[model samples]
Target: MTDTALDMSVETGAASYGAASVKDYVALLKPRVMSLVVFSGLAGLIVAPGHLHPVLAAVAILCIAIGAGAAGAINMWYDRDIDAIMARTQKRPLPQGRMDPDEALAFGVFLSVASVVLMGLAVNWVAAALLGLANAFYVFVYTMWLKRRTPQNIVIGGAAGAFPPMIGWAAVTGDVSLASIILFALIFFWTPPHFWALAIFRKVDYSAAGVPMLPVVAGEAETKRQMLWYTLALFPIGVAPYFVGVGGPVYLAGSIILGGLFVLSAIRVLRSEDHKPAKQMFTYSILYLFLMFALLIGERLAA
Candidate 1:
């Protein structure tokens, strides 16, 4: 079916040729998150110590993007009720009634299956399995369960987002390696502090939705303390690639400096009574992850 037909079917519960607009279809893809997934997967592919056919690599990345989009769509569908009440997610298609929940669910399931199957057939089963696992974890484990039940939701759910690099590495080598796992661990450990910082400022939204985010349950002070602790732990883990031979001087230095800055930001958040420090830490966390990944790829290229 055409994109418009698919969207209309989901939106109006009718199979029609015309729909609201192409943007409606694009909205289902969660393009913002997809960009990060694609970039990280590409970095993983680039840094893998093996050759992948250019066309196959392109296809693998496409599958990863689609899988990520599918998971995001499912998340939006499942969280539509809570999302409708949250300022941050009020404009999402499902919560806004721009699309039907059943339609979103179907669309997500279709994309998830297609992406995994295509990845398996076109590349290898390892990548496909990882992609499938990520989708399942996001949809079932994160969106359906942890998101509503506990503040540590993002801590465990974050693993879904961290799998792209491992999937990309597996696409090239058809197996998991310590290097890929290290990359995964870096993101996994980094997610709590990254998201909890946002929660510190957005705790009101989460509280209204009845989501027990750490900041809401533990109080902002304790949440900030936990953020600091996670950052401290993440520092050595982030820099581990250097000692493991997967990274070089550039990555080692970058990880240390970036990790130190992250810890400092967390400390500032811990010390401040206002939201300014949390806001700064929240914004800088994105840059910290991106720079760390870039340094990894740059070191690989330099070597």
Candidate 2:
């Protein structure tokens, strides 16, 4: 090859191998999802009976975020085929061919291992184990196995997301407790309604992707009914932190109001014939979880 042609070929190979930009990699991490995971983990750290050094607490949160992102990156890589078929996901790095699949997989695996190892070194093995379990559940259970196979995917898979707070609690206390379990339940019950609301609104995208989302397999009416039941279940679980002594009276009252609104949102979804209610519920669900965790964290800090 001529010198100029050789140089061009090298550049072409580099581009073909891994030309993805920083943002594309960030998309692989699913930063928006990471934010909620981090926040919940922080809440767990803040409310646990023992104090973690601020530096170690920060490390724990970082580990949780990285682990969550690692799972997300692996999920994106695994689902790239379905992602390409779904309009909403079509522009993602893997689906768009902006990133090499092997590179993405390696990035995810590396981050997963690093996050767990660092957590064990910097925090406690209990926290590290939970983080590893969450990552494995998200990747192997939720992404690889459950997601395409069943309508109960999010319901069963939601356990993976619920682990962060428990992990954070263990980072401080070095063991899981009733308070942490209540926190876990809060997120576990919340996940179904939250994702089902999105599924209701994105039925077409899910149906086209050949993913067996509740709405795709069970129908929207059934999905909405299930969402309502989960939201109803969430109300009591949201307030259980208060009963368990992790949350204060302010949290108790706030959770009541928030939980009421959540139920109302589900009711709205049930009554509406259009997607607007589901879309609204989806947006509100994010805010509800955020505020619920914030309330607990704030109340604990104030005490």
How much lDDT does each candidate structure score? Answer: 0.90, 0.93
RMSD (Cα, Å) for all candidates, in order, is: 4.4, 2.1
Q: Candidate 2 at residue 64, lDDT?
A: 98
TM per candidate: 0.93, 0.96
Query: Which whole-number lDDT from 0 to 100 does residue 288 have in model 2?
Result: 98
Which regions of candidate 1 are displaced past 4 Å?
Answer: 1-19
**Tens digits of lDDT, candidate 1, 1-303:** 899877766786553323335686678789988987887888788888889999999999999999999998888878889999999989877765666578788988999999999999999999999999999999999989898899899999999999998999899999999989988999899999999999999999999999999999999989998999999999999999888787898888899999999999999999999998999998999999889888888878877
Worst 10 residues of 1 by lDDT: 13-22
Distance from true location, Cα of 287 in model 1, Å: 0.5
**Candidate 2 per-residue lDDT over residues 81-157, each given as its tens digit:** 99999988898999878889999999999999999999999999999999999999999999999999999999999
Error of 2 at 56 (Å): 0.9
